[model samples]
Target: MKNSRGSLVRPHPLPESASRPVVTPLSPSVVYASDTPDALDAQYEGRVHGYTYSREGHPNADVVAARLDGMEGVAGGVVTGSGMAAVSAVLLGLLKAGDHVIGGNQLYGRSLRMMKEDLPRLDIATSLADPGDVKAVEAAIRPETKLILVEAVSNPTLRVADIDGLAKLAKDRGILLAVDNTFTTPRAFRPFEHGADIVIHSITKLLAGHSDVMLGWVAAKDPALAQRLRVFSVTAGLTASPFDCWLAERGMLTFDLRFERAQATAAALADHLATLPGVKRVIYPMRADHPDHTRAAALLQGQGCNMVSFELKGGREAANAFTRAAEGLSFAPTLGDVGTTLSHPASSSHRALTPEERAALGLSEGFFRVSVGLEEPKALLAIFAEAVAAAVPGA
Candidate 1:
C-alpha cells in the first residue's frame, strides 16, 4: 500500500521538543516536522508515523479523530473535508455498483440529493423512507440493500429516529446502519451505544461550535470497516485540512459547556415561542407536542439539542419580518454556531426541493430553524419577543 509518491511506510517520529508543552497543551503541526526525505518517503508509504500527507493525514486531524473516537466509543475513525464528504465516503467505501441503500427522507437537502441523484449515477439504488418509522424502513429493504442511512435527529423538522430499533433491523438483515449524530453531539447522544455500525458527525455544527470550521467525522464500530473508510478518505482526497482539524479539536475541549448552555437556551426558546403572538407552532424534541418527544427524550439523554424549529403565524412574510427585526442574530444558512442565528429552510437548506417536496416534509413558507447559541436565555427571549412584536402586523 503506497501513496502516489513512493515514501517509506513507517511511523512519523515525534519532534524531540514534544516533551515541552504550554499550559493548555496545543499540538499543531502543518507538516510532520522531522527528518525530511525519509519523512516524505514515509508519508508516501503510509507508514506508522501516524501521518504521511496533510491531505491523507496530519497531527491536528489525528488529535480530533482520536478525541472523537474516544467520545463515540468507536474502534477507529477519520475526519473528512465536510459532513457531506463523510457521508460520501461511507457510501463509497462500503458499497459498490448494484448495491441498494435505504436512506431517510428526512435527511438534509444535500444528503437527499446525494442519495437520490448521485447514488443512481454510481449505479447504486436507494429507497427513501422515514428513518423513524421501523415498519416503513423494514418494508423499504430490498434483497440488494447493503446500508441504512439515518440522522439521529432530522434537520429543520426535528424528527427523532429510533436508532436502537433500526440497528437491530439492520443487523438482523446483515446490513450496515450509519447514524448521522451531528445534531446531537456525543455529550447528548452516542449512536454506537445503540448498536449502530457506523456513527457520522458533521463536525462543522455543534462539535466545532463556532461554525468557522468545515469538517466531518466517521466512526466505525469495527476496525476493519474503519480501515476501509480511512482508505476511501485518503484515496478519494476527502480528508480534512489540518487547520480546520485544529479548530475542531479546540472546539471539542469546551463542548460540554457550550452544548449545555445552548441546549438550555433552545429549550427555553421553544417554550417561549409557543406563547409568542406571531408563532404558529414550535417543534422541539423536548416539547410534549413534538411527535417524537418520548423517543427523543430516551435516546438524547433528555436534552433538546441546540436547535428549535418554529413557524410564524404570518407565514413567509412574518418569518422574513422577524429576521429583519431580530437584533444581534445572523441570518445564516448554516447551523451550530457559537452565536444565535436563524435559517429559513424554504429559502436556504431545503431550497432545492420543489414546493410539493418541501410541503411533503412539512417545511412551510414560514418555517424558521434556530441554532441556539450561548447567549443568556432571558436576553435571547427578550430579543425574540421584541422582534416578533415588531414583525407581526397589528401585534
Candidate 2:
C-alpha cells in the first residue's frame, strides 16, 4: 500500500464507461501524460489527435473553435485570451515589417489605436479609410498593402461596411480582407459568405450573450492562415483559460434566442427614442435614416444588431443627468448583458480619440450607446422616457 502523502498526491482515475457527458467536460490540466515519449512527440507534432499542453492546444478551446468554425463557415479557427489577442494574432502572425494594412476609420477604438499607434512602432504601415466607401479603400491600398480590416458594422456609430465590394477589391488586389463580426455576430451576418478571407469576433460580446466571459476567436477561410494564427497564438501565450472557454460555451447555448429578443427590443427602442424630446439623432442599422441603411439591409439578416446609439441636444451634462435618472438601467462601460446597459462613448470606447477625431465621427459628449437586453419593452421605454426628460429638462 502507498503512504498517505503518495496517495493524496495521486487520486484514482475515474473508471472507463460507455456513458458520455452531455456537456463538454472542463479539462483544466496544464499538462497531460502519455504512455511513452514517442506518443507525446506524436501529439506535439500533430501526427495524432491529442493534447500535450494547454497553451499549444486544449480540448475546451478546440471544441469552441470548432463550433465557431461551423458558425462562420470557415476552414478552421483559433480562440484567444481576448478580442484584442485575436486581432493581434492576425496582425502579427500574418503580416511582417514593411507590409501595409488598410483599416476602417470606424473600427473599435482599441483596434484603431493598434493600427494607428502600435503597428507603426513595429515598422508596419497602416492607412485608415471609410469602409462604407469601397473606392476610398481601394484608393488607400498600395503596392505593399497585404490586408484590409473592417468591422461588419462599426462600433458606437453603427456604420456598415460594404463587405462584398471590399472583398472583391481585396481579391483583385491580391490582398486579404478581415471583417470583425462582433457587433453583428454570425446570426446577423457571416462575413465568409460575402467573400471575406477572415472573420474575427469578440466572443465577450453578443456571441457569449451574457457578458460574463472574456474570449475572442479568429476563423480563416484558408487552412494555412488558420494554422498560422493558431501557432502564433500559442507562441505569444494568448490562449484562453479552460474555465472561461467553458463559461463562454455555456452562454452561447442560448445565443440565437437571446440575440433575437434583444435585437427586436433594440429596433423598437430606436424608433421610440428618435421621437423623444431633446434627441439629436439615433443610430441603428435597421433605421432608414442611417447612412448605411441600404448596405446594412443587403448585408445583415433578421432585425440587424442589438445595439442603439443616440445623442442628446444637451451634450455632456445631459448624459450625466440621464445616467443618474435612469432607475432600472445600469451604467456599464461595456456591453452585451442580460439586463439593459448603457455605455458613454467619449468616456469608454473612444476615449483615446482626440476631440477632433471624435467630432469627425459625430461622437459627441452626449452620445450614448445602448445594449438592449431581455427586459420588458414597455419598462425599458418608460425608463428611457423619464431619463430623457430629466436630461433635457422640459423637453
Candidate 3:
C-alpha cells in the first residue's frame, strides 16, 4: 500500500464501546498513472530497479506489492486489478495448452467457473475434485498436472483445506501449489511458510476490509515464477490503480484490529446462532464442534478468521426472507468489509454453479454466508436471529 494514507485515527470499534484510537504513519500522493507502461524499458525508467512504465511498475503499485510480499514472506509479488485478474495472470503465466490443473471443487464460484469454462477455452485441461477428500486430490493428478489450486479457507462454507499436505503432494508431483488466502489473508495464514509455491489473495475482501478497493496480489516463493507472473500481468494489462492499492493498503494496516473484533463476533454469533431456531447447522472453523477444528486449530494457531456459514432449516425461501429482513446487515456478495455482510449462497456468490455442481460441493439452498465485522457481536446476532425467527415460524 504505497502512498496509502491509512486512518490517521485508527478507530477500534469494540463490541461494547470504542477504545482510544491509534493512527497509521503513511501519506503518499496516491494518484493513478496517466501512462500505462507496457515495455520494460519504459516501465522502469531507470528507477530503483527496472520499472519503466505504470502498467509494468509504478512507484505506488510497486510499494504496495512489496508490502504484500513482505507480509506473505515470498520472493516476489504481482498486484492486479482484481482477485480474478491475479488468478487469470497466474494461470496464463504458468499453464499452457496441454497443461493439467487439478482444482478444488468447493471454491469461490468465479474461480471454479474460470477453470471449468475459461481454461478449456485456452486448451488447458482441468480436473475438479473434492479438496476435503485428500484421496481424490492424489487420484486426480496426472503426469501433465502443472498446478494444484485450493482456497486456504473456501468461500460461502469456510472449509479449511490441508494446505501443507497439498503442498507436499504438489512437491512430489512437481506441480505448483497455489493457495487462495482471500478469506484468511496473511493475518491468519501464511501459505508460503506452510510450503506452498504460490499464494494469491483477493485484497478486495478481507485484506481491504473497507470494501472500497478492487485489487489482488500473488506472491511466489520462486523468483522465476514471480517473473513469469509479472510478464503475464503486464501483457494482460492486469494492473491495479494506484488509488485502489492505496486504499487497500489503508485497510491492510487495520487488518489486525478489524479481524480481532470480527473473529470474536464470529465466535459469539456461532454459539448464539446454534441455539436459535431455524439454524440447523453452523460452520465456525475454530469451534470445537467443527469437524475440521483440529486442523484449523493447528494451522491458524492464534489468528482466527471471521467468516461463518450456516444452514437455515427453512432452505432457500428462509434464506431469502432472512436476507430481505436484514436492516443493519450489508447484503452484498462480497466479504471482509468493515460492515457485516450476509451472502446467500444459492443465489449470490455460488449462483454461477449449477444445482448439481453446488450439491456435489455440499452447498445447499439453506446455506447463508456471514462475514463477521466490527459490529457488536450481540447486535449482529440479534439482527440475524430476528430475521431467522421471521423466516421460520415459532420461537
Candidate number that wins on TM-score, 2 or 3: 2
How much does candidate 3 score in TM-score?
0.88
Q: Estimate each model's TM-score.
A: 0.91, 0.97, 0.88
Q: What digit string (tens of lDDT, one per residue) describes model 1 on residues 116-136?
A: 889899999999999889999
User: What TM-score should be assigned to candidate 1?
Assistant: 0.91
Per-candidate clashes come to 10, 0, 11
Instruction: Please write out the lDDT profile of model 2 over residues 1-395, one tens digit for every residue.
Output: 65775457655666898999999999999997788999988877879989888998889988888888888887579999999899999998999999999999998899989999999999999999999999999899899999999999888888999999999999998999999999998888889989999889999888887778999999888888888988899999999989889998998889899988999999999999999987999999988999888888888855577999999989899999999999989899777888999999899989999999999999999999999999999999999999999999987
- When 1 and 2 are scored with TM-score, the better candidate is 2
lDDT: the better of candidates 2 and 3:
2
Q: Which segments of candidate 2 are over 4 A away from where they belong?
A: 1-8
lDDT of 1: 0.88
Clashes of 3: 11
Instruction: Report RMSD for candidate 2.
Output: 1.6
Tell me the whole-model lDDT of each prediction, alpha carbons only.
0.88, 0.90, 0.82
- Quote model 2's TM-score: 0.97
